[model samples]
Target chain A: MSIFLSILALVIILISAGLLFFLALPPKRRSRWGLRPIPAFSELVRVLGLSVEEGTRLHLTLGHAGITQPTSASALVGLQALERITAISSVSDRPPLATSGEGSLTLLSQSTLRAVYRLNNALDLYDPQRGRLTGVTPLSYAAGMLPIAYDENVSAHLIVGHYGLEIGLLCEAAVRNNAFTLAASDSLSAQAVLFATTKQPLIGEELFAIPAYLQTSPAHVASLRVQDLLRWGTVIALVLSAVLGVFGWL
Target chain B: MVMRSPVATAIAIGVGLIVLLGYLLPLPVLDPIRRLFLDWSIILAAVAGLVAILNLFKAHWRKISSSRERDYYSLFFILGFILTAALGLLFGPTDERVRPLIMSIQLPVEASLVGLLTITFVVSAVRLFALRRSWMSGIFLASTIVFLLAGSGVFLTSGTSQVIKEVLAALNILPAAGARGILLGIALGSVLTGLRVLLGMDRPYSE
Candidate 1:
C-alpha cells in the first residue's frame, strides 16, 4: 500500500511538472499542454485604445466569502483587479470604480488601487478617503452598491472571487444599469448555481486564470497548469478506480 | 483629542493581549480571563451592531427627508427595522410572540427583497447574450442556464426529458470534483494569505 501510494504521488508530480513546463511556453509553440491566455483588463485598453472621455467605468468587487478563502485566489484576483482597473483607468481618463463586500477586502482593494494609481501618476484619481468597511451584512452592501452602479453610469462591472446567491442582485443591478458584467469565482457549487443567473459567469479554476492571463508570471502560469494536471489526474484516478471495482479488484 | 492618548493606547494593548492569550493559551488560569473577554467581545460586537443600525437609520432618513425617488422603500425598510428591533429588544429573544412577529414581518419582507434581487439577476442573465462572448462567458452562460432550470424543478420531471438528464449529468460531475478541488485549494490559499497578513506582506491595517 505504501509503495502504491508513493507511485501514485510520483505519477501526479510528474504529470504536474510536465503540464507546468508545457504551459510555460507561449501559445505559438508546440507542447503537450495547451494553455490559453485569458485577456487582461490592461489589454482592453490597448485593443479599444483609452477612451479619454466618460466612455466606460469598470466596477469591481472582491466577493464576500473570498475574504476567508483558504487559497488567496480571491485576494489575488482582487489585487489583479485593482492593478488592471487602475492601469486601464489611468490611460482611459476615467476613474475606475470598485466596491467590496467585506471590510478587509474594501481596505485591501482601496490600498491596491491607491498604489497602482500612484504608480500611474494618477494619484488624484485615487480616493484617499474611502476605507475598507463597506458594511456588515451581505444584502446591505448590495443595496449600498446599487446606487453607485446606477449613478456612476458604469460601463463595465467585473466581479471576481467567491460569491453567494445574493450576488445575483448586484449582477442584475449592473445589467439594468446597462453595464457589461464579467464575474468569475472559484467555487463549483456557487458556479453551478450562479451560472444560470449571471450575465457573465466564470466557473471553477477559471477565477485563478486571471493572474496567469495578465502578468504571465511564471508562478501564476505554473499554478494554473498544476491545477489542470490535478484535475485530469483525479479524473483518471476515478476512471481506474471504477474499472477496478467492476472487476472485483477492490 | 490629544495626539495618541496614553490611556487609550494602554486599553488597546490590554484588549489585544487578552484576545491573543485567549486564542493562544489553554492554561486553566487563563480560561476565566478568556471567558470574560469572550463575554465582553460579544457585548462590544452588539454595540458595534448598534452603530451599524444607526448608520442605516441615518442613510434612510436622509433619503426620505430629501424625498428622493424610491424613498418609499426606505420608509418601509425603516418601519421593518424598527419593528424587528422593538420586538427583539422589548420582548427579548425568549418572547413567545416574537417568533410569530418575526415570521410575519422579517420573513416576508426579507424574502420579497431578496426575491426582487433574484428576479433582477434573471433579467440580467437573459440580456447577457447581447453583451459579449468568450470561454468565460460560455462557461458562465451554460452553468447559469442549467443551474436555474434545474433548481426551479422544471427540468427532468417529464418522461420526455433526455436533454435534462444529459445536462444534469454534465453539471453534476464538475460540481463534485470542483467542490473537492476548491476545498483543497482554499485551504492552502487561506494558510498562505493568513501568513501574508500576519507577516505584513499584505497590510492595509497600517498607514
Candidate 2:
C-alpha cells in the first residue's frame, strides 16, 4: 500500500509539472482560459477601485503565519493580491496599509509594497510604516487589528492567510465599521467564522485562485487548471476506493 | 533593476527537495539533513519573532511620541511589554509568579474574546440569511438552530434526549466530511504553491 501510494504521488506530481511546463511555453493559440468568477474577489476589485477613487486606504492583513512557515502559502497569495492591487492604486496618496502578525511577514509586506512602488515608478512614495507588525500572537494580532478596522480612513479590509477563531473579532470589527470586508483562511475554524462574519468569504481552494482570477497570469491560471484536474482525480479515486471496499476487492 | 538571485532559487529548491525526499523516502542519509533544516527553521523563526517584538515596541514608541489619538493605549502597551519582559527576565519564564502573572493577563481577555465569538457567530449566521437567501443559507441556519438546541440540552425527557443525541451524532458527520474535504484541498494547494516556489515560478522570498 505504501509503495502504491508513493508511486501515485510521484505520478500526480509528474503530471502536474509536465502540464505546468507545457502551459509556461509560448502558446500558438491565443485562447483564454475560463474560470468561474468569484464574487468575493470581484467585490474586492470593486472596493479597491472605490478606495483608490475616494483616496481612502485599503487594509490587507497577513494572519499569524510568518513567511518561512509551512502554512505561509496563503501569505504568498496575499502578497500576489497585494502586488496587483497596489499596482492599480499606486497613484493614491494613501497607499494601502498591510498588517501582519509576524515580523517576517511584516518585512515581506514591506518588500511587496516596495516592489509595487518600483514596478509603478512610485518608489519615492514608499513608506516602511505602511507594512506593520501588529502583534506576534493570534489573539493579540486580532486585538491590534480592531483599531485599524475601526479607523475611519480605511475603506476596505482584505484579510487572507492562516487564521483561527480570532478572525471573528477582526471581521466583526470591520463589519461594524461598515468597511468592505473580504476574508479567507486556510484554517477550517477560521473559515467557519469568516462564513458567518465576512461580507465576502473565499472557501477552501478558492483562496488559492485569487491571483489567477484577478491577474490571469499564465502560470497562476495553469496552476489553477492543474489543481482542478487533481481534485477531479481525487474524487474519482475516492469513488473507486469506496466501490472496491464494498465489493471486497481490496 | 530588481535583483533576482538565481542562488536564492537554487537554495530554496535544494532545501525543498531535501525535505520532500526526507518525508517520502525512508532513507537514513536524508534524516540528519532534514533534522538540521528543521532546527535551522526553528532558530530562524525565533529570531524573526524577536525582531517582531522589537518592531512592535518601536511602532508603539513612535505612536506615543507623535501624540496620536490612541497614544495612551500605546503607552499602556509599552509599559505592559516592559513590565512583562522585566518580570520574565528577573524571575525566569517558568517561575510560578510569572505563570500567574501571564495567566491573569491572558485568561480573562482570551475568555472574553471567546465569549464574544459566540455572539458574533450567531449574528453572522443570521446575517448570512439576510445577505444571501439561498438553499445553502437555509440549510446552514437550520443546522445551526438544531445544533444549538442539542448543545443547550433543551430536550430533557429520556426518550427525546436519546433521540436528540442520536441526531446530533448523525449531524457530526456533515462537518467532519466538510472539514476533511477542506483539509484535502488545503494540502493540495500547499503542495502546488510549494512547487511554484521551488520551480522559481513564484519568488516570494525575493523583492
Candidate 3:
C-alpha cells in the first residue's frame, strides 16, 4: 500500500514538472493566435457582474496547493482566473488582496500580480505585504484569511486552484459577509462544496479553460487542446481496464 | 567581472539526480541522504511555522491593543496557540496529565469550530439557490442538496432506501471523470516540472 501511494505521488510530481517546462518555454510567435474562442463579452459581463458597486476590496486565494500542485489542471485554471482578476482589478483600481498556502505559489502569484500592476501603471499602489505567505495548513490558511475577510470589508471573493473540504469554511465565512463569491478547483471534493455553496462553481475543466476563455492566450488554448486529448485518452484506458478486469484478464 | 552562470545548472542536475535516485534505489547511503533531506525539510518547515506564529502575534497584538472589533477572538487565538505549544514543549509530549488536558481543550473547541463552519457552509448553499436561479447554479444547488440529504442518512431504514442509495451513487458519476482526468494531468505536470527544475530549465530557486 505504501509503495502504491509513493508511486502515485511520483507520477504526479513528474507530470507537474512537464507542464511547468511547457509554461516556462517561450511560445512560437506565429502559432495561430485564435484557436480557442474566448468566452463571449456579454457572458463575461453577466458572469462577472460589475465589480462590487461600492469598489470594495476583492479577496483572492491561490488555494493550499501551489504552482507545482499535483493536480496541474486545476492550478492552470487558477492561474487563468488570477490573471483575469488581476487584469480587472488593474482597470478598475480595485486591487485584489491575495493569500496563498505554499511558498512557491506565493512567489508565482507575486509575479502574476506584479505583471498586472506594471501593465496598468499601478506599480506604486502595489503593497507586497498584502500578498502574504500564510502557513501551509488548510485550517491555518482559513484562520489567517478570516481576519482579512472581516477587516478589509471585501465586496467580492475569488478562490481558485486545488482545494479540499476546508474550502467550505472559507466560503461560509465569505458568504456570511454577503460578498459575491466565485470558487473553482480541480479536486472533486472541493468542487463539490464550491458547487454547493457559491454563486458560481467553476468545476474541473472549466477552471483549466479560464485562460483561453478570459485572456485568449494562444499558449493556454493549445495547452487546453492537449489537455482534452489527454483526458479522452485516459477515458479510453479506464474503459479498457474495466473490461479487462471483468473478463478475468487480471 | 563576476563568473558566468553555472550554479543554476549545477544545482538543477545535482538535485534532480539525488531525487530520482532517491526514488529508484533504497541503498544504505541513499537512505541516510533521504533522511538528511527530510530533516532539512522539517527544519525549514519549523522556521516557516515560527514566522507565521510571530506574524499572527504581531497582527493580533495590534488588534487587542487598539481595542479593535473582535479583539476577544485575537485573545483566544493567541492563548490557544501559546497554551498548545507551551504544554507540549515544556513537559514532554508523552506526559500523562498533559495528554488529557490537550485533548479536552482540543476536542471540544475543534468540534465546535468544525460544527460552526459546517453550519455556515449549509447556509451558503441555501443562499446559492436563492441568489442565482440559473441553470448551472440550479444544477449545483440540486447536487448539494442531494449530497447533504444522502450524507445525513435520513432516507435509510425502509424498502425505498435502496432507491435513495442508487440516486446518490448516480449523482457522483460526472465527478469521477473530472477527478480522474485532473489527477492524471496533475501527476504528469508534476513530473515534468520537477524534471525542469532538475535539468536547470527553470531557475526561480537560484540565489
Candidate 4:
C-alpha cells in the first residue's frame, strides 16, 4: 500500500510539473486558459469600480492563519485578494485596507500593500497602517473587524481565509452596513455561514481560485488547471471505488 | 515579478525539501534537520506575533489620536492590551490568576458573540432564500430544516416509522459526505499551493 501510495504521489508530481510547464508558457506560444465566470468575482469587478467612484474603502479581511499552518494557503489567497484590490484601487481617493488576525499575515499584508502600491507608482499612498492586525483570537478578530466594517466608510469587502462561525458576525455587520462582500473560507462552518449570509460566497476549494480570477497571471492559470484536472481525477477515483465496492472488490 | 529574491526562494526550497523528504523517506539524518527548521519557524512566528501586537497598539493609538477619526473606543483597546500584557508578563502565561482574569472576560465575550452568531445564522438562513431563488438554495433550506427537525424529537421518536428513521439517518450522512468532499478539495488545493511554494512557481512570501 505504501509503495502504491508513493507511486501515486510521484505520478501526480510529474503530471503537475508537466502541465504547469505547458500552461504557463508565454502567451505568444500558448493561449491563456479561459475561466468560467464566478458570479462573486464578476460582481467584484463591478463593485470595485463603484467603490472607487464613490471613494469608499475596500476592506480585505483575512482569517486567523499564519504562513506556518495548513490554513496558510487560504491566508495566501486572502493576501492575493488584498494585493489585487490594492493595485486596482491605488488610483482611488481611499486606499484599500487589509486586515488579518495573525501577526505574520499582518506583516505580509503590509508588505504586499507596499509592493503593489510601489509597482503602480503610488508609493505616497502606501501606509503600513493600511495592513492591520485586528485581533489574534477568533472572536476578538470578529469584534475587531466590527468597527472597521461599521465605521471605515467601507463599501466593499473581500473576506477570505480560514474562519469559524465568528465570520457570521462580520458578515452580519457587513450586511447591516450595506457593504458588498465577497467571502470565502477554508472552514466548513464558515463556508456555511458565508453561504447563508453573504450574497457572494466561494465554497470549499473555490477559495483558492481567487488569484486566477483577480489577476492575469499565467502561474495562477497553470495551478488552477492542475487543480481542475486533479478534481476530475478524484471524482473518477471515487466513482470507480464505489463501483468496486458494489462488486465486492476490496 | 514573483521572484523578488532567489536567495529567499532557495532557502525556502531547501528547508521545504528537507522537511518533505523527512516525511516521505523517514531518514534519520533528515529528521533532526526538519525539526531544526520547524523550531526556527516557531521562533520566527513568535517574534512575528510580537510584531503583530505592536501593530495592534499602533493602530489603536492612531485611532485614539487621529483628529478626523477620533474613536474613543480605541482607549478601551489600549487599556485592555496594556493590562493583559502586564498580567501575562507579571504572572507568566499559565498562572491561575492570569488565566482566570483573561478567561473571565474572554469566555463571556466570546460566548455572547457565538450566541449572536446563532441569531445571525438564523437571519442569514432566512435571507438566503430571499437573495438566492435557485434550486440549490431551496435544497439548502430544505436540508437545514430537515436537520433541525431530525436533531429534535421529530424524527427520533419511539413511535416513528422505521423507514422515516432510516431516511433521517441517511440525511445525517449527507452532511458528512458533503463535508468530506469539501475536505478533499481543500486538501488538493493545499497540496498544489504547497508544491508551488516548494517549486518556486509562486512567491507569495515575496511577491
Candidate 5:
C-alpha cells in the first residue's frame, strides 16, 4: 500500500510538472482558459473598487499558519490575494493592509507588499507597517485583527488562509463595521462557521482560486485546471475503490 | 514576468526538492542532509519570530506616533512586549512563574472569546436567514438547530425512540461526507501548491 501510494504521488508530481511545462507555459493561453465565476470574487472586485473610490483601505489577513507548516498553502493563497489587491489599489491613498498570526508569515507578507509596490512603481509609498503580525495565539490573533476591521475605515476584508473557530470573532468584527467580508479558510471548522458569519464565504478549494480570479498569472489558472482534473481523477478512484471493496476484490 | 530573485528562487527550489526527496524515499544519503536542512529551518523560524516581534513593535510605534491616528493604546502593546520578553529572557520558557503568569492572563481572555464565539455563531445564524431566505438557507438553519440540540445530548436520552437514534445516526453521515469532500479538495490544493513551490513554478517568496 505504501509503495502504491508512493507511485501515485510520483505520478501526480509528473503530471503537474508536465502540464505546467508543456500545456500551460504560454502566457497568451491564460485568458483563453475560461473560469467559472465565484460569487465572492465578483463581490470582492466590486468592493475593491468601492474601497479605492471611497478612500477606504481593504484589509487582508493570513490566518495563523507558520511557513514551515503544511497549512502554509493557505497562507500562500492569502499572500497572493494581498499581491493582487495591492497591485490593483496601489494608487489609492490608503493602501491595503495585511495581517498575519505567525512571524515568518509576517515577514513574507511584508516582502509581498514591497514586491507588489515596486512592481507598480509605487515603491516610495510602500510601508512595511502595512503588513502586520497581529498576535501569536488564536484568540489574541482574532482580537488583534478587530482594530483593523473596525477602526481602520476598511471597506472590504479579504481573509484567505488557514484558520479555526477564531475566524468567527474576526468576521464578527468586520460585520459589525459593515465591511464587505470575504472569508475563506483551509480548515473545515472555519469554513462551516464563516458561511453564516461572513458576507461572502469561499468554500472548499475556492480559496485556492483567488489568484486566478484576480487574473494574476497563467500558472494560477493552470493550477486551477490541474485541481479540477485531479479532483475528477480522485472521485473516479474513490468510486473504483468502493466497488472493489463491495465485490470482495481487494 | 521574470524571476525577481533568481538566486533565491534557485536555492528555494533546490532545498525544497532535496527535503522532499528525503521524505519520499528512504535514501540514507539524503537523511542527514534533510535533517541538517530541517535544523536550519528551525533556527531560521526562531529568528523569524524575533523579526516578527520587531515588526509588531514597529507597526504599533507608528500608530502611537501618528498625529491623526494617535493610538496611545499602542503604548500597552509596547510595554507588554518588553515585560514579556524580559521575563522570558530572565527565566527560560519552562520556568514555573512564567507559565502561570502567561496562562493566567491567556486563559480567561481566551475563554471569554470562546464564549463570545457562541453568541456570534447564534447571531450569524439569524443574520444568515435574514440576509438570504432560500430553500438552502432554510435547510441550513434547520440542520444547525437539529445539530445544536443533538450536540447537547437532548436526543440521546433513554426516552428517545430507536427511529430517532437511527435517523440521527444517518444524518450525522451527511456532515462527515461533506467534511471528506472538503478535505479532499484541500489536500489536492496542498499537493498542487507544494509542487508549485518545489518546482519553482510559483514563487510566493518574491515577485
Candidate 6:
C-alpha cells in the first residue's frame, strides 16, 4: 500500500511537471490562464505604488518557519511576493522592512533584497539591516514585531508565511497602528486571526498564487493551472471512490 | 534580463532528484547514499542556524549602540539572550535549573498567547458575520454555536439532548472530511513546488 501510494504521488507530480514545462516552453503562444482576482494581491501592488509615491515604508514579515522545514513552501511564496514588491518599490526613500522569526528566513530575505537591488542596479541602496531576525520562538517573534507594526512611517504591512495563533498579536498591533494590513498564512489558526484582523486576507492556496498574479511568468501560470487541474481531478477521484464504496466494488 | 546560473540550476536539479528518488526507492546501494545526503543536509541546517544566531546578536548590538528610540529594548534583548545562553550552556540543557527556567518563562508565555486565542476567535467570528453575510459565514456561525452547545453539557438530561448528541456526532465527520481535503491539497502543492525547484523553473536557492 505504501509503495502504491508513493508511485501514485510520483506519477501525479511527473504529469504536473511535464504539463507545466510544456506550457512554459511555448514562448510566443503561451496559454492565457486566468485566476480569480485576489483583492489582497491587487491591494498590495497598489500600496507599494502609493509607498513609492508617498515615500512611506512598507513592512513585510516572513513567519518563523525555517527554510528547511515543510512550511518553507509558504516562505518561498512569500519571498516571491517580496521580490515583486522590492522591484516596484526600489525608488522609495526607505526600502521595505522585512522581518522573519527564524534565522534562515532572515538570511533568505536579505538575499532576496540583494537580488532585487542587483536586478534594479540599485545595489548601493541595499541595506542588510532591512531584513532582520526578530525572534526564534513564535511568541517572541510576535512580541518583537509589535514595534515594527506600530512604527509611524510604516504605511502598510504585508505578512505571508507560516504562522500560528501568536499571529493575532501582530495583526492586532497592525490594526491599532492604522496600517493597511494584508496577511496570508498556511496555518489554519493564523488564518482565523487574519480573517478577523486584516482588511485583506489570502486564504489557502490563494497565498501560493501571488507570483502568478503579479508576474506573467509562464512557469508560475502553468503551475497554477496544473494545481487547479489536480484539485478538480482529486474531487472527481473522491466522488468515484465514494460511488465504488457504496456499491461494494472495491 | 537576469542571467541564469547553470551551475546552481544543475546542483538544485541533481540534489532534488536524488532526495526524491531516495525516499521512494528501497534499493540497498541507494540507501546509504540517501542517508549520507540527509545527514549532510542536517549538518548544513545546523550551521545555518548558528549563523542566524550570530546575525541576531549583531542586529541587536547595532540597535543597542544606535541612537534609535528602541535602543533600550535592544539592550534588554541582548542581555536576556546572553544570560539565557550562558545558563543553558553552563548547566546542561536537561539540568533541573534549565528545565524550570523554560517551564516558568517560555511555556506560560506561549500558553497565555494560546489562551488569548479564544478572544481572537470570537472577534474573528463576529467579523466574519459582519464582513460577509454569505452562506459560508452562516454555516460557520451555526457550526460554532452547535459545537459549543453540544460540548457544554448543559442539557444532558433532556430527550432533545440525545438528539443533539447524535447530530454532534454526525457533524464531527464533516471536519474530518474537510481536513482530509486540505491535507491532500497541501501535499499536492508541496510536491509540485518541489518539482518546480528540481526542474529549475523556480530558482529560490539560486536567488
Question: What are the per-model C-alpha RMSD values against the true structure?
Answer: 8.8, 2.5, 6.1, 1.8, 1.9, 2.5
lDDT of 3: 0.62
Return the TM-score for each candidate structure: 0.60, 0.92, 0.69, 0.95, 0.96, 0.92
Q: Mind giving the per-residue lDDT tens digits that candidate 6 earns over B13-108?
A: 887788777778666777787788878877776776677778878878987787755467788778878888888899977899787886797788
Candidate 5's TM-score on the B chain:
0.90
The CAPRI class of candidate 4 is: medium
DockQ of every candidate: 0.12, 0.51, 0.24, 0.64, 0.69, 0.49
TM-score of 3: 0.69
The models' CA-based lDDT, in order, is: 0.58, 0.81, 0.62, 0.85, 0.86, 0.78
True contacts kept of each: 0.14, 0.48, 0.17, 0.64, 0.70, 0.40
Off by over 4 Å in 2: A1-4, A27-31, A67-69, B1-3, B67-70, B151-157, B160-168
lDDT of 2 by residue, B1-207 (tens): 132668877897889788777766677899899989978977887787787778779878888888446466788899989988999999998999898989898889888888888898778876887666668678767877876776676764666756766777787688789889998898778778777776778776666
Which of the two, 1 or 3, has more TM-score?
3
Instruction: State the lDDT of candidate 3 residue by residue for A30-148, as single tens digits.
Output: 34434444333334444344663456777778777743335543544454456566676655545677777765556555656665676667788766555565546666676678777
Summing lDDT over every window of 10 consecutive residues in candidate 1 chain A, give the lowest-scoring window: A43-52
Name the candidate, 2 or 6, with the larger lDDT value.
2
Ranking of candidates on TM-score, top first: 5, 4, 2, 6, 3, 1
If both were scored by lDDT, which would come out higher, candidate 4 or candidate 6?
A: 4
Which structure is stronger by DockQ: 2 or 4? 4
Candidate 2 residue pairs in backbone clash: none
Candidate 3 chain B: 10-residue stretch with minimal lDDT = B188-197
Ranking of models by DockQ: 5, 4, 2, 6, 3, 1
Q: DockQ (C-alpha) of model 6?
A: 0.49
On residues B40-119, what C-alpha lDDT tens digit does candidate 1 reach at each position? 75666456445545655665666687744546667876787788788888999678899786777645756777888667
What is the CA-based DockQ of model 4? 0.64
Single out the weakest 10-residue window by summed lDDT for candidate 4 chain B.
Answer: B1-10
Those runs of model 5 whose alpha carbons end farther than 4 Å from true positions after fitting are A27-31, B1-3
Candidate 3: regions farther than 4 A off: A1-55, A65-95, A101-128, A133-137, A176-178, A208-225, A240-250, B1-17, B24-39, B62-75, B79-88, B139-207
Worst 10 residues of 6 chain A by lDDT: A25-34
Q: Rank the candidates by lDDT, best first.
A: 5, 4, 2, 6, 3, 1
Model 6 / residue A142 / CA error / Å: 1.3
